[model samples]
Target: MALMTTRPWKHPKTGIYYLRRAVPADLLARVGKREEKISLGTKDPVRAKGLHASALLELEQRWANLRCGAASLSEREAHELAAPLSAWWFDQHRDEPSQQTFWRTDLGDGLWPRRPPGWSLRPAVGAALIEEAADSSVHARCAMEDWCSEQADALLKRRGLVVDETDRRKLARAVAAVMQRASLALHAAMRGEAVDVGQTLVVRPAMPTSAMATPPAEMAQNSLLPISLTALVEAWWREAERTGKAASTHEAYAHAFRLLVAFLGHDNAHRVTKHDIVRFKDHRLASRKRNGDLVSATTVKNSDLAALKAVFGWALDNGRIIENPALGVTVAKAAKVKLREREFTAEEARTLLRAASDLTPGRELPQTYAAKHWIPWVLAFTGARVGEIAQLRRQDLRRETVAGYPEGVWVLRITPEAGTVKTKQAREVPLHPQLVELGFPAFVEGGRGERLFIVPDVKGQIAGPLQGVKNRLSEFARHHVIDPGVSPNHSWRHRFRTVATEAGVSGNVIDALCGWSAKSVGERYGSVSLKARTDAIMRLPRIEV
Candidate 1:
């Protein structure tokens, strides 16, 4: 007697097996039953078990789809979802020869002919059009046609597709044929011409192959047809941001996928596989930045692969791809990033200040070279991150008095209200007397915009402009800051710490001054008054440039 294990159920009558899982009451109606079960359809337990596992995996995915909706751009699902309506939309409006067009010359009444009003009112033409329209919008139906055409063109360009006038016509006709049938399905369904469910829809043929990477025979499977990788990425990114992911998180994810799409020969994402993912992982590990150091696998895993994984997982759950190419991929965890201990020695700081001064012209407009010229000096004295300094609103630098203190201090508030920050916790740093002495206040007053810095919004819908400032700061460091061990904008904080330490400033005072969070309860309690920190910072030496 074959016995059923807890995981797989056995049917005693036929000695076959079935896999069963309970459906939640909430999903019972959607799934259409109390428990979901699928017969293994084999007598051999081993074969049945394999089938059982596969079936179980698929069932779980189906349930997930019920919960989250389709999210991928896989060939079969795209075809099933898009081809019918898009084809109809295109067929209803494609260009044709004047002599023998199908609707005009071949069919007596033409597509959507002026059928009898009563005839259309029945559950046939009018009802079918209404039903189809209800399922998808006119805009969506029309957009899919354009989307397919673009997909074809992208593949054609990538494959180096060459075609004569005749071949091009055939390609057009081939795609048109799919759309024609798609239109036909809607018409037939409405007109009572459909004999069954299969007749109510048409199977779309493979996309035009002349420009496809794979040949016709190889492209025979509908799933093998390409969905535009970049298109999918753009769509996914837009949706991701819309659905309330943080702007920074969405940008990070988009950056990775854009790189992936560029690296993978810019093909349909469906064409990529686990093998391609491995190659991408290896390439990232072996790759070097402009500074020529091998990139860390951890970065690839966290930023690149992590983003790709979320996207691919969405695609997989939604049925765009049958399997996630990024699944089961692993990268070694990165050790904590240690900033080099180097800082600006006194002479180097003086040299950078002199160089910065030369870059600032007489005009102090925020948009001018003069304002950009002031950014480094601002970072140097404030010990603020370059981005923090660059993204400041004029109002960020304000005079405020502490509750217990009698004297007012000029403070620079680093907060996300003005721009993005690494630490969400807002803090106030004292404006070094040097900045005030150099007429920083007068320069800001001259600026036209609310922003203190002139970096344009290179960041699109998903990124912050401060990223540009950060990169420029790095470039500025490469030339002006000039020490390999010290990252340019970053070294400012290290140098500030150096000065603070020499002035006998306590660790708690440095933490409060530099926006570092409390590391321990003692440190949290040890935070000194703002005036005390300002006084500590003021003790540092200033040089004449």
Candidate 2:
């Protein structure tokens, strides 16, 4: 008899565990699903069990909250109820006095100091002046009144709390007061003076080393050390080992943390807070690149904010910290300005195809031979990302039988076995007749090497060499196409989508061919078979270059 165990269901292909639950009959229509298969994202059975329980509880809470409907609170109740948040804010900012700025606002007659446009205030004073300001000045504050107004919604969402517009305003004002008190205390500390901002301003004493549950020796070797930046990042990287994420992803996250440490002049991640992150963001935005342009908001959001959220979220889930400080912090991207069409024009596509097809063999590096001669055609026909084609292996191409086709279709399997696939799901793209006519099968059979394009490392990871070949391919394409708006390689993706749709290909078939994620729950129910993909592949019109 098989051993009986209570464990999360393991995925056959990915080997990751999932929390599989059937939806309650009444909720089926509401959720638009009869079942929920949430990924635990871990291969370890022990870790999967813990993650499964937490995920199930969270799902249950969400359903409960949905059934309960929106709850309301009085404005006074909202304001008074924000006391704990105020205390938490104080605790985060109390020791960081130098990070605060004090502005003078007159309460009498409501007339503030009149200053020139864009004028900034700077003061060089000791404890005496700061204390005098705290005592005599009407309100020692920063721009938190306006800041809180903007952040109120996100703040409420982070705490899983909700409020009406009337109550939200009251809550913002209460938060503003809390921030002002902390700012006052910070200002005082800047000048070597201490100011009392009531009971909430109290900082907790550190626990004695001897009294801690975990011994120092064990804590020293713990990869989940909350205070050590390196430890935290390493822990996240280890957890992501089997996640099908790119190696460059780990490097980017590690680099983001390094940048943070350099800016803050410390590696103690536990000491970092939201205010520090805000300050760093402001500094980053104010700085410029080598081209003398301000860093784009999208870059900061994707790189820094994304890194912080991932690492801190991992730390919190593993019980390294009580909360993720990066939560509720975000940079809004500016509206994109249109220049030209993103997709390549017919003439541009023809130019690239003709150039790629005309490339003489044995002239360039042996590794980039496939990238130059074949990858462009592959991308043009399939709409797969350049990386996906660039990382393809010679063995990935095979002939598989289909229901309608007697001879079967030649399929190119885009699998993580080649490298990191974006969706972490293997997909079979049928070779377009145009590609087979161009002798793609002969090219695959002719190669003695393992990979069709780039070389892999000792550990069989192709991320590093994969990037190099991709760059070389882009450089080759850039020589033929000179559009500023259209990417050298990515334009193929856009162009293929247009050509495929124009050829009467189904959206779901196109998604399967290109590895694009399904847009709806209903779309995820069934698999897009090889027969369907072959039919769609035949529909794609050949580029007459």
Candidate 3:
């Protein structure tokens, strides 16, 4: 008898190799199948092996997408995918452009010296109304920004549709392309090469050559728009919130924008061009901090320039502006100040855990010590982040029966409901026996609060409690754990990783327990059972002061 294998299973009738792997029982409910099969399209053993690997990867990705609530394209989505391509094609062959140029009689749309082939192929739009619009002088008199907006409005009316920012750019680009060729016709007409077509009177371009100077009156007209820098920042913030961006991201953008508004006068976004932004960038690079102190170039990039990029990019894409002022601007990457990884020594970890076990509540410790005490211990043992441990709720502590495990497991569910996870993936970290032995489970069982940790908050406010806990933890670390090399609460996580690795735990298991995705293809197929994680965790030496 041969050992059963789940490689490429060959069909008896067709002699074609088909990759066959039994889908995990847990995923079967969501996947709606017990097993997944993909034809390898080959009978050769080596070729089948290669094909099987590729097919299996795609299947796994599909399953992952399913778990993440991303489904295959719907009817509307599939059409949208093809819509851009078809629209691009339509603009490529739009025949009414030369006709419009005939009506314009202006160099901007007139026949050009360097016009691409098929310049004359555009079918003339005989509709006098469209021709009247094409020849409208209202835009040519206005500022370029207003002209562009008017043109966009005209485009929408012409197409009988409203479009998103993506389509607006496409139309803008197409309009510019048409204008380029037509502008050349001005040169042709000036050089006495103007051709006579029916109803086409050669029009001259308004823009003058070197010999011709623009009028002083036209130059004196103000280009300053009334839309302020504050407006753009506010809109970006609203969009960020609407799109479900993380709270921390909103805070960072807010801080940076405040610095920009303060320094740059919070004037009109339209009034600020590339030149204005360059000054702001230069000022920061030369150590003009918002606090008026010298900071590194890296700080400028992370805060000021990066925030502007997000703001200007959003404004451009949302059709709030014709172009992004911050498009090509950047603070060049500079060498960063190197800092050591914060990790406590083994002995220090033991001491910290012991002190957290102090049951006495005082002015310094308070009643919240129940949670504050366990936070460091949990982080030290689990290597979970401070943010993750601090945000745990009463319901998150679980002892549940899992499939394939004879005995149930005690696991802490770290998720986003109470607070945010850095990776966004919720993971189960098996509770260490040492923590259980230290009455951690009993403490949790006794808790009646909605939150695992108690932090002060103001009504209708979100950041108060979270920020409070973090500040308190930092103070605790500074006072108790006096190490120049290690940070307080965060050092506990680093120490856990250090000890876990030293104790010969596999990297993947540690990553799994810490809410990290698999780094390898094969690792994706198998489950990291609670028993395996529990066993691996038990391998660590118990902390002792």
Candidate 4:
């Protein structure tokens, strides 16, 4: 899959967001343009993001409609399309008793309040008469009908549905009926009778499938039938969750599946075949990144193929399918080349640490300040993954007395309890003596939140706020490091090993402290005690800024 540059573009002059997309080659002729652009009308990034998503959804739906052309609409399809109209009407009028007359008399043919003829001669009465005339039942109904028609037209355009005049009239009639139903419900509310006015009317325009609501086993029995992609992914996710698959991983895989479905132009998972997978692979490989570089083979294999294979395998095991469409698909391996050492050099490490230490307060969030300042130092000493250090909590940092030091050592606990751990196992690394001298303990004690680096509200969302911090940190590091060959945050792990070895720390003890997997069965038999780990950590020298 290609990287998407679908985020809202901000204008340089006005600071307002805009939607910018190039029209597909085939679509250009039909759309009559090379590209489509729309102002999002908001300077606020959050609002712009929401508006952009909605606008993008409608654009995709419109393009899809153009591709398929107009189709015959069944009565059921018309009714389904019009269902939200009723809920919308009910919500708008549920609390207004004055609006009852419009619903009670077919928009007030006999119920309109009349303006006295002689009273119109007086100026005050003339203004009053005009106001009454404007508020009459006939005008109210006309406005209501026009609004409904406009909504129905927009809905049809958004869904890319085209209908003949007769079918369009049929839809208009369906809208009227639904609106009447809403009116009746409103009347019930007025009469102090029970009504379901709180009905949520989210409009989802997905491919219709009978197998969507069926159990996986039942779906397998009718394997030839179409099953919706949404249903398949939901079921897959439920099982995946049970097995302790990371939610962020699921989010990425599910997004990949959606992209596949979009490329396929349908959501039928059952209809997908090996040929489709191969064609998708070819298409993905031919696709390019935003910078015009060809999408990496590694990305296609790891993200797209990996997701498809896992989901399809789950489907097969659950009896939803007899075969996995993604089976045997693989990307050819490229030779691993060592351009330079993956570890940071002494100068590069010092450069990053110095910049971090210089970051002052009040520029960003408290957690961000902590991340920018101490996270580098923590990673440098502990040799932990950047994410592990970024997600550390106040409770995870504790003082414990171990051998060789009755004064106690400050241990940073790397555990899944805080967030995700690659090994699914927890371990503790004693803080380096250099960190203690740098007032790392005072910094940890200063924080008042649950997390030492990440904010509490965003801690639950693995892919949202935490990912934002990671991206920002990467950007911040790259600005100083200026090395495209090495990863900004991850190079610390490599450098730590090098430094530890030079300091004469044992390999197994280094692995344990760094949370690496045991090399052999014997190595796994005995645990690395805090005392031994403390001794090892004490041996390693710290980076001097």
Per-residue C-alpha lDDT of model 3 across residues 1-545, encoded as one tens digit per residue: 21233577777755766656676666677644455544554567887776666656655665665555533333343233223222221232233223222213343342222445864465663464376467646344233334334444443422224456555544544443433444344334445564342113223221111001111111122222334566667767876877667666666677666666676885556545667778888876776433354776777777778888888766544435534566668877757444666688766776766777764677653435665687878887788887787777788888978555467667898887666777777777888878888878787888776676754355734455665677677666656777656767777767777888999998888888887778889888887777778877888888776
Query: How do the residues 1-545 of candidate 1 rate in per-residue lDDT, one tens digit apiece?
Result: 22334466766644545666787666666544455544554566777666667666656665665665333334443344334333333233332212112221122112222456687467567677777677534444344344345444333322224434344333433444444554444455445453343444453223221212222222222222345565556556676756646567767777777677777876667567778888988888888977787886778988888887887765543334434678768796757655557788777788787887777455444444544578778777777887677777778878778554466667888987765577766788877778878878677777777886654565522145656656655776578766677767778888888888887888788887788888987776645777777777687777677
Each candidate's lDDT (Cα)? 0.60, 0.69, 0.59, 0.73
lDDT of 2 by residue, 244-362 (tens): 56777887789789888888997765566777888888777787855355877887889988998899776654445434667767898678888988888999988988988898877
List TM-score per model, in order: 0.57, 0.56, 0.51, 0.57
Give the winner by lDDT: 4
> Candidate 4 residues 1-545, lDDT tens each?
22235898887755766667787778777654555555555678998787788778767877888888777777787888787655544554566633544344365233223467775578687676578677755566655554345446645754657778777766766666665667767777778887755553334323111111222343233332235666678788987888898766777788778888988997766557778998899999999955365988999999999999988866654435434678878889898677899998999999999999998877688778778888888888888998888887778889998977978889888899888788889999998889999999888888787777776453456555676677678878988998777878999999989999999999999999888998888998989899999999998875778
lDDT of 4 at 275: 81
Better of 1 and 3 by lDDT: 1
Candidate 1's C-alpha runs over 4 A off are 1-54, 57-183, 187-228, 231-246, 285-302, 314-322, 328-342, 360-368, 402-407, 455-465, 520-536, 539-545
- Give the 10-residue window scoring lowest on summed lDDT in candidate 1: 96-105
Residue 389, candidate 3: how far off, in angstroms? 1.6
